[model samples]
Target: MFETIFTAANRALVAGLLAGVFLIVFANVVGRYGFGVSLAWIEEAARHMMILGAFCGAGLALREGRLVAITALPDHLPAGARIALRWIIVAVMFAFMAVLLWLGLKFVAFGWDKETMSTGISRGIPYMAIPLGCAIFLVHLALFARRFVVQEFEFHAEDTPSDRQV
Candidate 1:
């Protein structure tokens, strides 16, 4: 349930970010050629949208296995070795996400007293995305690791002649 909600939010964030970019470009073009009235808020809004988009999309990327990996070595390894290496990579990723969650929360706590100049939104609101996204990414990573391990184990088991049927 939580994963579904977060995934939806991630998708929405990406769509919003793309829309913001399109609006900014369209506004600029219209202002330059048609109205001679440029929008000052478009750039600021676009910047904020970009940040939110990147953070929000990160969790979804982890869930979908879309992030880049150095697969050259893993690809050459034997089956068991490859599975072990993959597990190691997941462990490292989990550690990184933990650090990110801690630091991101600290950042938000420190900035909670501040407010944005134009929007008047609490600065902490935007900063909260860091920790929130990282936490979600951590959950997604753990689930992914569990699935990988389970699948590999099952595959190996099934490959055995005693476990197979002709």
Candidate 2:
């Protein structure tokens, strides 16, 4: 289940999206100046890819335990206390994911009829990334929760597997 979402394929998708953004933007710049012509759809594609990349990258970061932390409370807490803190963190993530998923779906529905300026793609296509990202986050959190219990409060950044390719 969660393994499906946290696969190397997703890592490749992120890499592809990032590459697409860079190439499109670069071509757009070259066309605008070097050739004095630019494709109208290029900007939209780049923007959408960037948005998707950002969301997917965020999920990857969350899954790998790479999100920035304050460490204010965790620094002072004991091992037992840290487990309680992590539980609280998971609860907060669940709540946040629920609301974001709901709003993202509504947003997708609302934009179903709307199309992009250049490609005429339904806005819902890109907007769908919202819920997709949340879904990824939910799966990640679930995996973390499982490990969180089995590891006996032993949640360390080093213990989380990363999908990054060096």
Candidate 3:
């Protein structure tokens, strides 16, 4: 269902980001040293690839719970309080994503009407990436919230460190 699709999207985004990094490195190195000449498109291509990588990677990070968080206080709280704190964090994240989504769409619309240009590409093309990324992030946040609501918060024995490991 939606979970499966989201998981697939996450994998795809990671792959694309990796590919972009590889392409940029290869093109820059080969063009500068081996060829003794630079391709005019190389820099622009790398820039766009970087933008795509960041936009897509953000959604994947959200899905994997790898985003930066301040949990020092929450870690010391009781179980109920910890769960409440997690929900509060999630709500704030959702609000932030919603604002990004709104602003992204507005930016795209402005670019479309203004008919801007960059790196030989229409400004709207690059602008579209913002909304696209925010939409994916919104979906990830919603799914994460749904799972949190259903499961509440369970402490797992597996999460604890063994005496030997400690």
Candidate 4:
């Protein structure tokens, strides 16, 4: 139940962010060409939205095995080696993400006093994607660790139509 809700919410957020980017960019283009006026803030807003969307989608990507990786070696390994490798990978990922989350928080704090030139909002608002994305990735890694380590990571299982439904 919790997984369903959490997954749904994440999907909704990614979809909303993508739609916002599309709409904002479309409006800006129309305004520029059709009306001969360009909204100065649109570009900034779209960029930030794209950034947030990418970060927010990281967990979903990882869960579905969509993340880029060199699978040649892992794909050729024996079952026992594969499981061991997966555990090691998970441990490394946890450590890496933990450091990133820490650094991201510091980055946000450092930028809290600053504001974006175009949006005039706290710079920390945009910088927040780092820690948020890292945290989400961590939760996803934890939740899926057992399956991932026990079984070979399979993208097809996660790509079914039912799973695609938000």
Candidate 5:
């Protein structure tokens, strides 16, 4: 169930939000230069799309271990110490996610009362990405943490093609 839902959401966000933002920005640029016309709403709309994409994209990035990490510390540690540190990292991440979600909801509430300058849309709509992204980050983090606990290393080995394999 998790895999099914995650797959669909990840794909849709990349395809829709990410792609849409790029297209809108491109059009705005072209419209401004070629036609000498500025779209006030386009900028606002693109910003929202970017926020949504960043939040949604976070889950996939976490799953892929594409998020930032301090590799030197982990690699230098002994096996047992490394494992212990992994749990610590995951715990910190979850805590951060929880705070983000809690505070993000409040932010969204605050935004709901306000509107964008250009689009006149509720800022909450864009702020929604915070809590939403936090949730997605939590889910992916859980999956990765579970796998990390089970396998001491090479958590993403299955997802990637090893160079040595023929």
Candidate 6:
């Protein structure tokens, strides 16, 4: 139940952010070229939205096995070796994300006093994407770690072999 909710919420958030960014950018472009007016804040808003969307979507990408990876070595390795390599990779990802989350928090704290030039919102608001993304990524990694290790890459939750068989 928790997993379903979390995944759904994460997907919604990412989709919303991306959609907002798209609409804003489209409007900005049309306004600039067609109407000969450009809102200064539009660029800043779009940039921040893109950052948030990319970061937030990362976990979903990982969970769906959409993240870019070089699978040549893992693909050629024996079953046990492939599994062992996956475990090592998972450990590295955990450590990397943990450090990123910590650093992101520190960065947010540092930016709390600062504000964006055009939007005038606290810079921490945008800086927050890092830690939030890392946390989400960590949760996803934890939830899917077993499947990732065992399956060695093809682990889309809805498209699993059992589901297909049924």
- What is the TM-score (0 to 1) of candidate 4? 0.89
Selected candidate, larger TM-score, 1 vs 6: 6
lDDT of 1 by residue, 43-86 (tens): 66666777777776775665544566566787798988978887
TM-score of every model?
Answer: 0.72, 0.81, 0.77, 0.89, 0.84, 0.88
For candidate 2, lDDT tens digit of each residue in 89-113?
7788889987999999999999999
lDDT of all predictions = 0.71, 0.76, 0.69, 0.84, 0.79, 0.87
Question: What does candidate 6's lDDT look like per residue over 51-106, in tens digits?
Answer: 98888888888766777778899989998998899899999999999999999999
Q: Which is the winner by lDDT between candidate 1 and candidate 6?
A: 6
Candidate 3 displacement at residue 99 in angstroms: 1.0
Candidate 3 residues 1-166, lDDT tens each?
9777876876787687778778777977898999887766666666766786677677566544456656679779988887787788779877887888799888877877554333566666778778777778778777767554333332335654331110
The model with the greatest TM-score is: 4
Query: For model 5, what is the C-alpha lDDT against the true structure?
Result: 0.79
Leading candidate by lDDT: 6
Candidate 4 lDDT over 1-166, as tens digits, reads: 8766887788899999999999999999999999999999999989988998998898888777667667678789997897789899989989999899999999999999999989899999999999998888888788888866664343554467655312
Positional deviation of 9 in candidate 5, in angstroms?
2.0
Q: After superposition, how far is residue 77 of candidate 6 from its true place, in Å?
A: 2.2
Clashes of 2: 0
**C-alpha RMSD by candidate, in order:** 8.2, 4.9, 5.1, 3.7, 3.8, 4.0
lDDT, candidate 4, residue 80? 87
lDDT of 6 at 165: 15
In terms of lDDT, model 6 sits at 0.87
